[model samples]
Target: MLYEGFESRESFDLLTVLKAFIRLLQKSPSSRIINVYGEMNEYDSDMKSWTKLFRDYSAKFELDKLMDQFYEEFTNTNIKISSAILGNDNNIQTIVEEADRIVHLAILPFNSSPKSKTMRILYGIVGEGMGRATRSKVTLEILLKEQHHVKVVVSNRAYKFLHDNFSKRFPSCDEASEGEAAIDIIKIEGLTMQYVNNVFDEKASVLHTMQRMPDMLNKNLDAYYKNLVSWMPQAVISDFDSFAYIFAKIHGLPILSIDNQHIVQRYVIPEEARESNPIAFYTYKCFVKAKLPRCNTIAVPPILRQSILDAKPLPVEHCEYFLVYQSSKSDTSLISVLQAFGEKCIIYELGREEKVDNLKFKDFSEHGFVDDLACAKGVFDNGGLSLMNEEVSLQRPFLSVPVENQYEQVLNAW
Candidate 1:
């Protein structure tokens, strides 16, 4: 999956897309499955209990030996691991070129800032969704279920996660790997992090993040051409985070912009609802504008278009109260405004270790939102692509509170 994009996380979109794809696959009588990813953190809280239960009874093994045991189990199955490509080397031309056959999908995660007009325009072109690898994997699984032969090449980190969670899915892939021809891989070295410092640096500003992008496009293009070139990419199937769509376009590939469901949920609600509840509308709009643009543009099958439209309608029941979460960087004034309603208001502050004694308050840290949302009456949160999508997939009735200065796409998505 593309890890860092307009917004960094993609866990939410991954769950939703997977759920939809899995349901589709189950309906088919016969299917095969192949999966790929970057780094797979098996011990993450979401999968902790499943891993524990699998080990305690289904397959007795020690916690520390999980990786080895997991790999061994897959090796004993029909799945194949032609060769493990370990690092972010973009230079694997030899291996990629030598493949007698190839099925390619690109995955990336993105969230956008509403305050940035450039981002909004970019969304109109690229759209939003989950990472490229993930969408490809889901697509692959569906094809496999149709009894088609499938193979996958993924980052080392993501490979381990799949091995642990889906080792038994493809018993024959193991044999297929052995039959494949061997080839050398060219490695591109380094992991350098770059950031723009100015609030309005042409390239760094949210609007121009893609417009001002230089490296993705060739140097000789006209100004408009350069802007469009930023999102172009080369893979057969690409999952572009925010601006990466520019690269996908240049390379002549189909792009899927993956992100959370809330990005699309806000615009779906009725105008009456938005007017009657100004606070909710304002808050929700803020989130969408601030973050949703990152996933503004996405490529979807025609069959899925109606489903996307369906996401906007408000749930049948209206919640009595709304719970607003305060992240580490939250404004104190906002906290005070939320707590003014007392117990009738549910407020959570993330990051601070200390808990408040006030009856109307609750402390929800970075990790706490996961469990609390499981039983929440209703939720009000940033239009983060990862969390919001998971909430929708879980069938929760919720409202998105996107940050104001960014993410206009989220505001318009519903």
Candidate 2:
């Protein structure tokens, strides 16, 4: 910017700088140009006097009002920005088709364009259990169906599950999106709980998290700066995932909390569901509130997988056997107790040895599992909110054995 007195000064070649700036703006619209040529890159209200030197400047010259006109155009919802203005059409076809342009914060693109109803979303999920993963899968598919570009940040089992599901279905955005869409799944470190004898071990879980904090921070930081910044999402969706929530806050982006866990903080619990253990209740409340206290929260019923949603469940009298699904591997006495019942029971425990009489151990497959659940007389589960909601949806009679000392699961069972 020039000093106010510079109009009368002959100390600098101001014309040369102004012309260079014009050339730079013609090539690319970036703030980087101002930074590159330091001192005097600015608009001068005094420059109107230069029209006296060039008589042609009066011919449709709106140089003095360029910014005002651009602002008006940018703010006008009716103006349509050309695809050419964004980039190579083939490379950013998805973005172009959606008409999403370069923007800062939540503002419309500076270029003249119609805004889109759909958005680019940064979605995060907790990797500890399959509950969050299963639910988020449905949400992601819905977003993709709506043609919203998404980038998922997760870790552990959730990362692998989502990666496998999305990779085969949609290739990278750099490639063509023939009739289908694509996504980028960026993995980061996440936390998990420790269980002993099918009970939550708070001490061990705390220690594990403390030890892994450094690795967690490093991976999240790398993903944040490298992939997340370039993606520049307009909104963030978190399913009990803190990393995504923090990212949304830092970038001043709108966030939508989509998870059942928010029921504790966002809803009124019945007296029966209130804390039997008060200390545990307040502690868990503090934790959940810390992640998302001010965001828009949508407390939804369990989002079931497509298979379960479409299944036709059978009655107990017509069904052949019951199903057993465990989220914890530390259930030492559960199989023995089931075996004593002397009725047929199907279970999933990957490395367990098989026994003949009453129990059947089967490898995990989505089709097989859904089929079993549909025909089962009942279910025995560790009270994962996702599967519990599935059982509820089917109206199947089941017994829930929630993990001890785990407030979320206890409330879920309640």
Candidate 3:
């Protein structure tokens, strides 16, 4: 769909689109579906080869045969579908002209913003974590500034974080007058991580997600389809969200993909680093590569907030505290570890919301965190790419203990 198979509730944006497309298909089985396969970015040499193979095969064989080959080589399950190859440039416009309705992925380009007199866009983002949401915020800001009518689908912590920020930044965007605003947010079901003894519990998390998935899927599908049919989008833009991707595939709509994960997929890993953990490294590389849709233009923009970019780093001598940022407040192990250092170093714990002991635990505020981080001696926390990047950008030492059983964090830490 947007990239590949649906993973979790984080991808509910994509799921909604897919459900809408299925409904359309059920109503009209004779619909002429023109699937357009997107090419991978130029930098991803390995994936580029696969793209070339698909392109060549599509050129040599019929649509059915090419789709069959695609399923055999790439996907685990067989999907009876046929597609045509369209060159990357202005693919969205082409799809809009041909298809009755369109759904596609969202990407924010610095040089050009989406402008249309006839196109209705549905933008999807994975909202389980803050990294995607943070990047989406910047993108949404640009879209709204350009006056693009975008319907945003998000869930879990991301929905609250985005809604709160948007409310403060654009007070006119309140539900009382959604039509007057350039953007509208729709809440959906999203996955929640499980933690045991302050570490991510993968098995428990998977079991919990599985248990709720059926109900979540049914409810979200119904809601998404109803919205999709009502809004009648002309295109879709996905940030590695599968529901949008699938919707585009089934309906033959133009889609664009944009995310930071592509940097990992495209960048050449050093031989030494690959050798260090060959299995993990390769697994992660393949996982990221497969997760994204094979789009013609895969834009990998730098993911950093303006605050992090503008804030000046403090001098090493003046830096005093060991700044701690935890996603969960329930994790006392991290608190205990930081507290052991006692008054030797001021332990500033930024978590959900609280105040305990010498550790100053509080809710996350962009300006407040940046101000504290500017004067921090070091950052102590789990391996989240956003914080790690900030610490490195500021030239501060980072001591990361990745959440257990979370391979993504483990890879980030490495």
Q: Who wins the TM-score comparison?
A: 2
- Lowest lDDT block of 10, candidate 1: 182-191
Writing each residue's lDDT as its tens digit, candidate 1 over 160-277 gives 3333423456542312222221111111111111223201122334444343233222121221121222211123222223233443453434544443333334346666555654
User: In model 1, where do residues sit more than 4 Å from their true spots?
Assistant: 1-328, 344-349, 352-354, 358-371, 384-399, 407-414
How far out, in Å, is residue 262 in model 2?
1.5
RMSD per prediction, one decimal?
Answer: 20.0, 13.6, 15.1
**Weakest lDDT window of 10 consecutive positions for candidate 2:** 32-41
How many angstroms is residue 326 displaced in model 1 relative to the true structure, after the best TM-score fit?
5.8
lDDT of 2 by residue, 344-398 (tens): 9999744565756899888656678888998999998877888888888888899
Stronger candidate by lDDT (1 vs 3) = 3
Residue-by-residue lDDT tens digits, candidate 3, 1-414: 322332222345543554456445435323323344444222223556546544533332333322333333312221222233344336446655434222221111112212323234677777866777777777777666655556677777787878887755542211212123355566777678888766777678789988776556544553344344334455788876766666567556688776656655676666665676677667767777776646564455366778888999898678766787665455656667666767333333333465456567656666787888888888876787777878888888878877655556766677
- How many steric clashes between backbone atoms does each model show? 84, 2, 15
lDDT of 1: 0.35
Model 3 score (lDDT): 0.58
TM-score per candidate:
0.34, 0.72, 0.63
Q: Cα lDDT of all candidates, in order?
A: 0.35, 0.67, 0.58
